[model samples]
Target chain A: MNFLSRLFGKKNIMTDITIIGTGNMARGLAARAIAGGNSVQILAHGDKAKADALAAEFTGQVSTGVLGDAVTGSIVIPAVYFDAAKEIVARYGDGLDGKVYVDITNPVDFSTFEGLSVPAGSSAAEELQKATGAKVVKAFNTTFAATLGEGQVAGQKLDVLVAGDDEAAVAAVAAFASAAGLTPIVVGPLRRARQLEQTGFLNILLSANEQLPQFQWNSALSFVPAA
Target chain B: MNFLSRLFGKKNIMTDITIIGTGNMARGLAARAIAGGNSVQILAHGDKAKADALAAEFTGQVSTGVLGDAVTGSIVIPAVYFDAAKEIVARYGDGLDGKVYVDITNPVDFSTFEGLSVPAGSSAAEELQKATGAKVVKAFNTTFAATLGEGQVAGQKLDVLVAGDDEAAVAAVAAFASAAGLTPIVVGPLRRARQLEQTGFLNILLSANEQLPQFQWNSALSFVPAA
Candidate 1:
């Protein structure tokens, strides 16, 4: 059966995911969405061709459109950089109300990688939540794009550390993650995004260190329970 | 054999560890030091009785002294709070030069538990390194006091993430951690301490979270490698 046929043939669709941007994260998340049996909508910021190319790569129930178009999915993932994610959130405004906005951007000051770009005590996810009425959930920030494509690091399942204030919003994201064959560890409320962002920054630092070859970008930040 | 006899009777002492502070972390680290067969010295800021009491618990080659007194061990662990640690370092001055200083304080702002108390581009360990000429190493910040006492979380060995600019200093700290029955994952240079401190803050936030019962004070910030 074709990807579209499989998507539409389902009696009850779990959730439709709208991914913004045409970058690696956008592609990675889109792949996971398709694998999880969810319809995906790819939105390009300015270049429609880029979105079209990304959409063409997948045969599932996927569509492409410009950024300003109406979002058609219950879960909107702004898989863009931190600044672009902010702009998308602001532009969506009240249209995103009640929507689960999945924020995967790590607001790291890449110039130094010594600290994050967000203000003290705040995170990109929390700031995005403030800019819009959408229930912003922090997920996939720690999962490198390359690793996300494989859907697992090493042999263990990818652990998606999720944090958000709204229980239903967090649950919605968690449901999608579980369906994608990832372990969803719901850390705490939305405020926990602060640490989640820091953890992402720490992981990035480890990946960039030339001395620690084993901690390349592909390593997973896992919570191994005692045997 | 008694703790002291075992500590000094050996041809070579594994490591002489001097821990400052009478708090839970002090006791926890002292317990690990004794368990690792290292001679320990307990230093109290104002209360000699507290240090004496902690020393009395360990029948090893343990001693007690005030903060300004000469540090007796080759490796000194500042197990006090962040501010107190800074003060202790300043008071010790050049006396700490050439010594291996282990910084276990997580410079967190408990007011919000949202960010660190240190500056944007720095950490408690880095700041301590700058204050004194001692080779400062970041360790045990991610390990909770309770977990340090047990040396493991959920049966898995505690992963002690170490960061220091000096290679030998980092190795010394790593050796102590290994002898104490913990896995020492040396992350990178001293700058990596920034991320380490942030990770500590993040872990603290999770522990303080009321909703996440599983992430109590005893939980660990672990990096589970692929099986």
Candidate 2:
């Protein structure tokens, strides 16, 4: 059951997702993706040991190497920094011609954490989408890495608010989210990624609040229907 | 059921809720407060005609006056711009020795809309509280005026998140919110107003998103409690 099989009218399509980093966010997402029953691979930029450790830790169908190694999957997810996203995509031997690129990094100026690193009107995901000609979709930028790793918060599984213009690609992502034990709330088109980034920034501000400075990373966005 | 009646054992302490400004927000909040059974008043800064029209439109309960009039009974809520919040409060008077001052304005630099206009590491409500010794509490900043006017969306009543150092003050504001037909969500302490302001900013960003632009001012923040 591989991606190729599913694409050819076959019942089995085990979507293989390859993450390009071994950092906290990358490892967290890789673990979740692995837990969701998808084939996961780890690409260590320099530290091969760290990547191998992550692969072993999650019991994932993971492999380790430099970015140029054949990614062997249809959906090659780069779970790294914004600057690294394009670089890693460039490292792939065959460009993402028919792949759905998902950008989750919040290109925020962490030194300030008060504002974004991008221009006044633009966002990180939009920039990355343009940088790599891959069909980029913005998702998983609002939730924290801790919550992403843990999945359940205060016992209730968290919700992932996703937005992207591609309906079919978004459907694939929503399925992936469900596999990760998250309730995926599809908000709107890709540009709404700005909302996700801004909301992520606001959540960061909330985490800095003195009164509730210690807010658990478990909190999430939910839609409560009117009674 | 009046403020004094609920307080000093009089069973007759009338809550004189006066809003300064004849803008849509002021009109909307005043209408909700009046519906909540408070003795509401409207003090027009300069547009007495609009104030009178709104007062007449809602009912005789909301009277109009100049900005400096002493708003007797209950709490005196300052519904104005963050920069103007302090100025309006000063114009109205600083002798708010024992009254609860509800600050619903989010400190947004509308000219930029990139972030807040106030000092970094703080929020509009916090700044207002520091400026006035009127036991300030933050509430209603999370919802749009239109949503507040509508009271609910998709059958779900909207939530008004309140935060303040004073528990009693927060509770009082919560009472007012409940009276207005919205759900009051007490999100920890007053210092959390910083977070509330940030949340408001993010919601504005959501509205600014092109694809789902104006996806109904009906949308609101709903909590997903841990199961």
Candidate 3:
């Protein structure tokens, strides 16, 4: 079936997953969603021209628009940095209520990578959820945009850590990852976003280290539980 | 040569690695040291009897003493929790000067697992270093005691992340890990211990989740950088 048909496929697949922002992460998530056989709607935070340019690069059922333009997807993934994601959430207001929002922000202080930008004992996902009162699931924050686009790291399948209070929303995000052929580990409740963010920030710190050339921006965190 | 000979081998191996506290972590680290062909000196926080019992369980040159005893090893690894490590550091005072102190405490708020016991912008290792001008190397905090004792995780060589500001101290810890057949990734300076502690705490949270039975106390964090 075509991307359009698969998006609303025989199983009554949900609406197009709306993506806000036109950047590396946005492009990467869009590619993953399409790879999972779901249509994608890309909404640029600003400058529709960039969104249009990014969408044009992809094949199948994909659409693009400016941020304030209506969000068409049942699941919304703001694949931007922490501050931009917050701004998008603020602009959307109650519009994002009930929407399956996915937060993939590290919120680390880029200048020093010493600490997270979000308040202590809290995470970007938690703060954004509190701001919009949306069903926010923290996923893909640990995966590099390049790895997400490539769908693997060092010849191994990538594991996406998912955390959210809403069960169905968590399952939905898990399913999205599964459909894309990535293993989804449901870490725990939304509070786990704090750990997930820290983990991501840790990877960021390692990536920034010039001494360790192997741990480039693409280092992936893998945890293997006992069989 | 025997463990004692290896401790001061013909190459001038070095002093026995001193491990403080008689907990599972102490046993794990001591076992690792013996596995690396080095003698071990364990100092119990309060009960020398407990330290004696634990030392008696080992197969090689191992000694036991109370907390106030002179630390024999140039490298000291406190396997106690965060607070006890601090108390031990305080008691040791300038004695720990120039020592390669290994901090394994996660500093997690076990009461809720919602936050860390260490203050913002600091880690358990960083705090302990400030307490005693000891050259602290943050290592083994990411590995479970059981897995460390076993020397491998799920049939794979465990990747021990080593972070510290001291070059020789970091190399000492890395050599210790390497002698035990584990891969040591020198992440960065000691400040990066903040991330290492968070990584360990995240593992704890996952281990506590009933839904994830596989991620029991034995769950291991393994990261493979690009070749």
Candidate 4:
């Protein structure tokens, strides 16, 4: 895409985004997607009440029964667990084909939060790319869920680092991020997920109270010129 | 230590630091420590000639013999290889005791720069802390070695992330970083080394040639207010 096209891609932009998962991050991103001037739908497994509640809260639609409905949108956001992603794709099937699938799950082994659940030398995003055969793009895995709820900070906005081997899919997610009032930092390729996970680890270390007595959770990475 | 002492400890400001590695990172930090007004030294083994050559080019001192002579000052910096640290520590022995030891090395298995050397639950800095009695402090492991040498970019000094259980040691390294014309960001306690290493991994991901194309090697992390 041209620089101007990429920059103003979201201008007067109205797109369809389907959020898969009923968890906090899914809810949060769904709300932001609405705020970003897009149609959003939440898909949860046998949890229509929670989905309905989020829909009511965010003024978006909710899909509790059919996975196909959730994957029908132009941008299908699988904001669910990593292990659950394969099942999600299996259920959604070819409905996800030809759509920009955004995988925002951390895929971290929550029991340890030390290593990844994916096999050594492999990435969860890459696995999802292989499983679904959909255009998979990685984004929204860096920021804290609470930060996503707040979205903008200090009158500026948070940056969403997006990575994917697919150029057109990456561009689509970048537009979605911009529509949500965020600056999308497109990292190199899908393999860059390894680094994205590492960045998340760094942020967690800096923010988590168990690590340091005086460290606050508010600090973030910003780009500036040489001092 | 009191909050103010922890914030800007005066005692460590006067501590002399001798870096024991002559790699790019070692050279970068050595330059900074010298700028910080601390007595800086470089110790290189096997390749003492290369170390000496770098020291001469940078106008610093290089040591090949005894660790005692190299670490006579208040701070001893082990900037060598991950596997080589134990040997260096064994050689240093009593010389490392009662001194603030700064660890700027990442256990990144360069063989597969895509992954870490140590297992998920451990960190190189922590391992150094355990093996050596020299109150260990983890710093300057988050950024690229090139960025470290350059010090600042786009009119802003790069921030050095430091983590360790020892407040005094961390503060000392922070002072050294500041003096070298870089910002010292004390990112919590020692366990946060995991985060810093992960940050390094993220940086690598951003720079991976096959990944996100916009992630230039020169690009780095900086922060500004929410606005």
Q: Could you report the Cα RMSD, in angstroms, for every candidate shown?
A: 4.5, 7.0, 3.9, 8.1
TM-score of chain B of 4: 0.81
Whole-model lDDT per candidate: 0.83, 0.69, 0.84, 0.69
Candidate rank order under TM-score: 3, 1, 4, 2
The parts of candidate 2 lying over 4 Å away from their true place are A1-16, A19-138, A141-219, A223-227, B1-16, B59-61
Kindly report the TM-score of the first chain in candidate 2: 0.84
The order by descending lDDT is 3, 1, 2, 4
Give model 1's TM-score versus the native structure: 0.82
Report the C-alpha displacement of residue A218, candidate 4, in angstroms. 5.7
lDDT of candidate 1 over A1-227, digit per residue (tens) = 23643667422333389899988888889988898998887889889899899989887888777898778779999998899888887787887888999999899887876678898768888888889988989999988886777788767788898999999999999999999989888887787787788788878777787877777677788654334
Q: How accurately is candidate 2 docked according to DockQ?
A: 0.26
Clashing pairs in 1: A164-A190, A165-A190, B4-B60
What does candidate 1's lDDT look like per residue over B1-227, in tens digits? 34643667522333388898988999889988888888887889888899999888777778777787778779999898899989998898998899999999888787866568888767888889889989999999989898889889877789899999999999999999999999898988888887788778767766676765667788877775544
- The clash count for each model shown is 3, 11, 0, 26
User: What DockQ do you compute for every candidate structure?
Assistant: 0.43, 0.26, 0.64, 0.36
Q: Kindly list the per-residue Cα lDDT of model 2 for residues B178-222, writing each as its tens digit.
A: 998987877766766765776676665556655554344546765
Q: Which CAPRI category fits model 2?
A: acceptable
Worst 10 residues of 1 chain B by lDDT: B6-15
